[model samples]
Target: MALRTGPAHAENDPATPSQRQIYSQSIAEHYDYRFGANQPFLPSLATTDTGEFINSKAFPTAKYCGHCHQEAHAEWRQSAHANSFRTPWYTRNVNLLMAEKGIEYARHCEGCHNPTALVSGAMTKGSTINRKFDEDGVTCSVCHAIQKVDTRGTGSYVLAQPAVLVDEHDQPIYGEVSDKEILTHLDRHSKAVMKDFYRTSEYCSACHKAALPRQLNDYKWQRAIFLYDEWQLSSFAKQSPLPFYTKDSVSTCQTCHMAREPLGAIPDYGAKDGKLASHRWLGANTIMAKFYNYDVQMEKTVAFLKNNVFNVDIFGLEKNGSRMIAPLGTEPVSIAPGDILTASIVIQNKGIAHSHVPEQRDMYESWVEFEVTDSTGRVLTHSGTIEPNGDLDPRAHSFTNRLVNIKGEINDLHQVWNNRVVAYNNTISSGRSQIVRYQFKVPTDARGPITVTAKVNYRRFDQHFMDFAMGKDHYPMPVVDMSSRTRTFSLGENPATPPDPQDNPLWMRWNNYGIAMLDAQQYSESVHAFEQVARLRPDYPDAFTNIAIANFSWQRYDDSRTSLTRALKLSPHNARALYYLALVERNQGNLDAAIADLREVIAQFPRSRDAHRELGFSFYQQRKYNEARAEYETLQTIDPDDLAAHYILSIVYRRLGMADKASHEAAMFADQKDDPTASTYALDFLRKHPEVASESVVWHTHSDLEAAPSHGSNAPAQ
Candidate 1:
């Protein structure tokens, strides 16, 4: 439905019907005269009847929850989810990415991943969230208060007033239907109507999805994180009812992750009267469980995921113990110095329950490390390495993706440098594939087998980072080797090679490219260059995709999709293509077609994220909020603090119209105004967005309208 529009001051104008505006204006007036809209009707902090934590105190802390829920607490402590704010890894990378970009770009990541620390007023110049509350990460308050989810993948969850139960004397009281523990604090917990929208997948879309750059490629929607979407296209999304899969029996995320535990009988360990869902909330981060020495918790999480979700297929071993194929892609092919050598790597998001690399975490670093050397082992070429002090070599290629930061009007920076998240996210989606191409001159004097090695290296924290943030001894903060692969090229007795002229076609068709361009050595220059080509061939699908891809590299998913969709329509089923029509359908919040496309992709290319992420998202939109959250949450296990997963989950809360959730997510994007790369996403979004008439406006006291309520003349007699 189209939104109504009128003068900003039309409070009682019968021409328009939305009462929200009038309500907002009234609330705004109350704000000016009193505490205003910001006043949260929290239960009195001084109240004493709320249940006591394991330790009784006036104001119990999160630590109190740990006593009764020892297992959950311990797991949380080791997981990034627990250390959202104080994780040394996030701290160091956040500082680095922001330093290189700007502060405005960094906050987008901080919103969900480190919300407690960010909102506690901890983040600022030369300061990080390393305190008590911040250390607790996303505490109970963060989730319990989530009343709504936006679901459009914009990360627009809404925060709501505390649900309180009142007493006969009109005193405030609060109760937990989920827990038996009572608190000392009390508040009015009237049953507020929670819209079923909270259950839908659209709720996740609000934040998980990102918009593309309008300046570079025109505003388009790119599918950045697609966990929910991925599941929608999977067998899990289908109902077998009376068929092979079973009638009305469809697999849901909650079915596996949040399954209720059966009650059992015991003396001291007697189970609750009803079934209780496991709150361990575990996923793929077993390493974290190991880090805090929380072996039991880690083992539980690992066992749960390995037993429930997909299996891992590790490869890349050489027959003669010499070299292996690339860890992620297909076998490597030989090429001359000037040849545009091609290598296809298939880094499956195997273990993750949903999409891989869900969201933007400053410390979430994943890349293919490539080293080319002669048989003697002397390094001839290397990429994805950090220098001694802290800086990445200007010449080396990097696998770590980046977001855009558009803080200033004229100047734009990558999200790492600036705090703004204008648009553009470059992370591999679940069940998705990204192909990398590197062209180098085969040396004229090259002889024998020229070996090339590629490792899917992942690190929790950058090496030089800890010392830069928390001081020196924080050295060697573990960098885990998630996976690796390799291949050898026969450079046999090659004659002197001549320099090959550069082909601008790859640069000309940026839209066809995805993650590859995100790490392009000439990202900034290529952005402008591709834009010109797009302008020259405005109707060309490839041209649009090229420009769109550039915007996607900068984290502008919204804009990227527009062009990609057009490309798909113009040329369907192009194997070497980026976005499939079905994938676009799922991203646009379409379910059925997304399923079809995903199935088709699997039939054609067995390993694909297009189907999985889209399927998951579609299922989420289908009022399966818990299921959706589970899928996205599962992705985070593989890639901790994945921005895409968190963002999507936040949006699910927003679409449900949950106020607290919306506030949390809005905070993430609120500071985007200061980022250059982020500007493109927000600006294009607002411009193309059907304008929402002002929700709060002042109305002049003109003449009073006749009151018609209880009067025979259709007007109330005054």
Candidate 2:
């Protein structure tokens, strides 16, 4: 449930006080309020002790912050966050949203990018927006003012009232007065900067994870950004009982971005031995730094992108009879002319906490550029070429997620509200790798020493998004070469037969390729890749389990059952295998078998959420309302914010004639039903003005409601 700090009001009321007044009151009343659960909610604005909402003007500028924090301020001034709201690219989109859906709807975008404008009441309809302080995007005061944070991502934070010293006349002191005055009121500065929340990933998640309100998307639930959740599930920040957990090596948001550095101007209170965290907040966004002409920052960003966080290698080559693929080695390979060679470019996400291109993947572009040439500089074959019109080659392999609207058309624009289907998602997750294979005939008269080069390139925004955002005034987005590998092959006689797969050291390479295929939702291709492993090592239980998973995803129930049977026969107590087998049994209408398998899974892995949920569902199917209620109650205890559990419990309680319990569960369901940020009022305006969708070149993808079931919690990981 979204906690409001302001006075209680009717749900349907529209003419309440201005957002500024509400925000001020909320902060004043709930200054000490802490989040009860990690549920997503909108953050309220910060306020002064007098119940006055803090605006951009209330905060000191970056220059003022530099007085005692020179190096940090200097680094921040060159960061993308400093110029976030003032950037031409950003303003263009914000203005477009404002014009199409009114200023009220645009608040969703401003909530993160231009919080100053949002909190100051400048974004209200017909209000005069003050751009004076817009340049100070995400300033020092805005971040330091946060008091409490909800575990939920997407700006679920509460701001504390600023601790300001008053003059003799009772007026607030605004800026730097004097060193002597600062020394006299040192406690106020200490209170502002001493919050432990500053070092937490939850603080960063406030803006990093955003979702489209159900009203905006015209769907019950729609997630737009997932960086926070991705990080939570990663080895760096594992909170759940996942199979992959690295206890010895743990990292936080501050670890990589805020490395320790010597302070240029030591603060009187916070500095420890003249060392402080570097405030560069460096990310893979060199284009913006280059556009802003921050030469030093651009250099640093470019260096970070090319630092081998992601690696690209020519894994292997496939031909008529056999394929020779392995991680890149010093050995040179010999290929014959006129032979059809299929080269595999393996792109691995090695160090990123989430997917390679983490957030706003629809607009951002990450793809592989493969090129093969001869010693004479003659281009033999090339993929991922940039067209004359600034478009990428259609055949190029892209690591992006494509959304489909209700009409089953692609939504090229970044308006995620209309998304219904994740038609394709090829982004590589952390510790995963993708294999893109290209088949081309080696020319009969081809010269010796054919060089193959594969590069993984990243762009902040793709050509299609830029075309819509900037139209004819499009500026070329810089493409960073993330990682690359070059391999040269000399013409020679091929080995009669490729090395045996069992004897080869690259078995894991093939297994990783299969997992990549699974991640991409290419079930058939994944099965084929896993079959190679099954053939090599028939006794390998994991290979059969993988095959079963692919079959299960494809809805081939009999095939899945057969594969699972083989897997269970090999390793009877394999929890993962048992979990999927239970799912297959449930889908096949074998309730008893499903329940039995789920019980076994629970006994093996006590904290299996999926097993518990499935067991409860099976009991509900059998009309055992009391048993269903008990299982759902356990689920509620495990995940307090489990909406599905609450919903099911509501029904079960009602069925059992427990009116009070039913009402309680129903209320919890109602509170969390719709996201606070999803505006029904704004949606009504959008429905009346359907032309907005037509005018935008971004709405290219049409959605198919029944395309495929979403890869939700029940879905198995690759």
Report each candidate's C-alpha RMSD, comma-separated, in the order given. 21.5, 10.7
lDDT of each: 0.41, 0.64
- The number of clashing residue pairs in model 1 is 165
Candidate 1 structure lDDT: 0.41
- Candidate 2: segments with Cα more than 4 A from true spot: 1-55, 164-188, 215-220, 240-247, 262-274, 321-334, 404-413, 417-422, 467-474, 494-507, 520-718
In model 1, where is the ten-residue run with the lowest total lDDT? 693-702
Candidate 2 lDDT over residue span 495-583, tens digit each: 33443332223555556666667766778867887887788778888788888888988889899989989988998877767878888
Clashing residue pair totals per candidate (backbone < 3 A): 165, 13
TM-score of 1: 0.44
